[model samples]
Target: MTAINFAVIGYGGMGSYHIHNIMPNENERIHVVGTYDISGERQKISSQHKHKIYHSLEEVLTDETIEAVLIATPNDSHKDLAIQALKVGKHVVCEKPVTMNVEELDEVLKVAKETGQTFMVHQNRRWDPDFLITRELYKKQQIGELFQIESRVQGANGIPGDWRHELKHGGGMLLDWGVHLLDQLLFLVDSRIEKVSADLSYILGDEVDNGFITYIIFENGIRAIIEVGTTNYTKLPRWYLKGTQGTAVIQDWDLSGEMIVDSGKKNIQAPKPIQAGVGLTKTMAPPSEEATETVALPKITAEYDTFYKNFYKVVREQAEPVVKNEEVRQVMVLIEEIFKAAKR
Candidate 1:
């Protein structure tokens, strides 16, 4: 199989990461031909790394040899860059949030359809090990029927970079981290959202939120809470899944956590009342040792690095994209709804 050649449109943090870390080798299915960045400093850096540096977007677009381009620019620039790449007969791999809003994304999607080029969003969080384990438990019922899921990421650092602090640039935890969390939830649930509510944090006083919490109710009776925090010094579990028969917690990116399930032992010992703050309460007591059994978190076999591999397949062999445009749009639509709900 031939490798699909790609160019980096914006050689910033994420763009640089892609060119260096993601583009594996000559043997891989994807190759980085060069980069296009308005910043001369970034262009110099790209050249230092032995990549062909294009001076302008036009220069990159007109290069008939480059089959695809990755848009790692600011969130607001995603729509125009994606549309231009598609119109020029190049497939596109865009960063998360895809665009500032659903309307902007819709316009890009229209161009992609007209040009018949693959347009896939980099919703890479779907491949996260923590999420993969939870998804496996959801599908296999390793514990039981999972009914509640809490997914979150927290940091003591405020907004990480300059543009991320400004609303015009699509800065904020909602558009930044929120997009990934929501995408993972949507991908895992596989059900229509029956209801939505949200609260965005502005404690840092930026025009955009520093954090946010969104509660989503699914048609299949599953409840999901997605949250992102910039002020949290101590953090909650990265993922918490509750099933009728067991519970699992993925504490951090390291995938630390545990699972406890129904013991299913006949005539298990009953729980005894425990001391409360001021009084004794049986309802708040812990489950008796005989009632539940602790187990290791389920192991998953999916790899997270397959994003570019799938992109190559979609662009070269007309394979269906793992990250579909419609799914990307749906996440954007849900983001819009979250904004409206927060306004209320």
Candidate 2:
């Protein structure tokens, strides 16, 4: 099989990562032929690495040999870049928050349909090990009928990049990290969202939010609280889930956490009340050791290599894409709802 030739449209952090890290030679299915960046400095860096650097987007688009374009440009540029690539008969792999808004995404989708070119969004968080393990437990009912999930990422560092702090470029934690957590929740719940409430934080005095907290209620009775924080000196668990029989906590990216569940044994002894600050209470006592069991988190065995491989099949064999445009559009719609909820 012939390898599909791809060109990177923006040589920023993620763009470079895709070109260098993800474009594996062993795959023998995809190859990075060249790249384009508006920044001359970034182009120089790419040239230093021996990558063919296209002088402009037009150059990459007009190159007939480049069958696909991986767009990692600013959020505001995604729609135009994607549409241009599709118009020129090039398939497109757009970065997350595929567009600034759903309307923008709709326009790109329409053009993609007209051109009959494959268009896929890079919702890469679906492949994260923490998310994957949580998904597996949710599916298996590891804690028995999961009803609530809390997912978050916190840091003391302020917004890292320049463009990320500006509103015009679609900079904000909601559009940035929130998109990933919300997308992961949507991917796992398997139900439509019935309601949403959100609060966007602007503590840094920037026009855009530094972070946010969103509450989503799924039609299947699952409640998800997703948050992104940049001012946290101390952090909370990366994930906390509650179900009928037990609770699970994933402390951080290292996946350090545990699950404690009620033992199935019958006639378990009730907990004896311990000394309290002032008053004695049997209602707030920890369960007896015999009544519950604590265990290490389940091993994570999820694979993340399928994103590019599936894209290869979609482009080469006309197979269904793993990251479908329709799914991406749904996330955009949800993002709009989140914005509105935050406004309220």
Q: Which pairs of residues collide in model 2? A: none
lDDT of each: 0.90, 0.90
Q: State the local distance difference test value for candidate 1.
A: 0.90
Tens-digit per-residue lDDT, 3-81, candidate 2 = 8899999999999988777765577888888889999999999999888989978899889999999999999999999
Prediction 1 TM-score vs. true: 0.98
- Tens digits of per-residue lDDT, candidate 1, 1-344, equal 88888999999999999877766554568889999998999899899999998999999999999999999999989989999899989989999989999999889989988889999998888888888898888899988999999999999999998999999999999999999998888888889999999999999999999999999999999999999999999999999989999999999989889899998988866789899999999998999988888898888776746888888777767888899888888999999999999999
Question: In model 1, which regions exceed 4 Å deviation?
Answer: none
Which residue pairs in candidate 1 collide? none
The C-alpha TM-scores of every prediction are: 0.98, 0.97
For candidate 2, give the lDDT: 0.90
Q: In candidate 2, which residue ranges exceed 4 Å CA deviation?
A: none
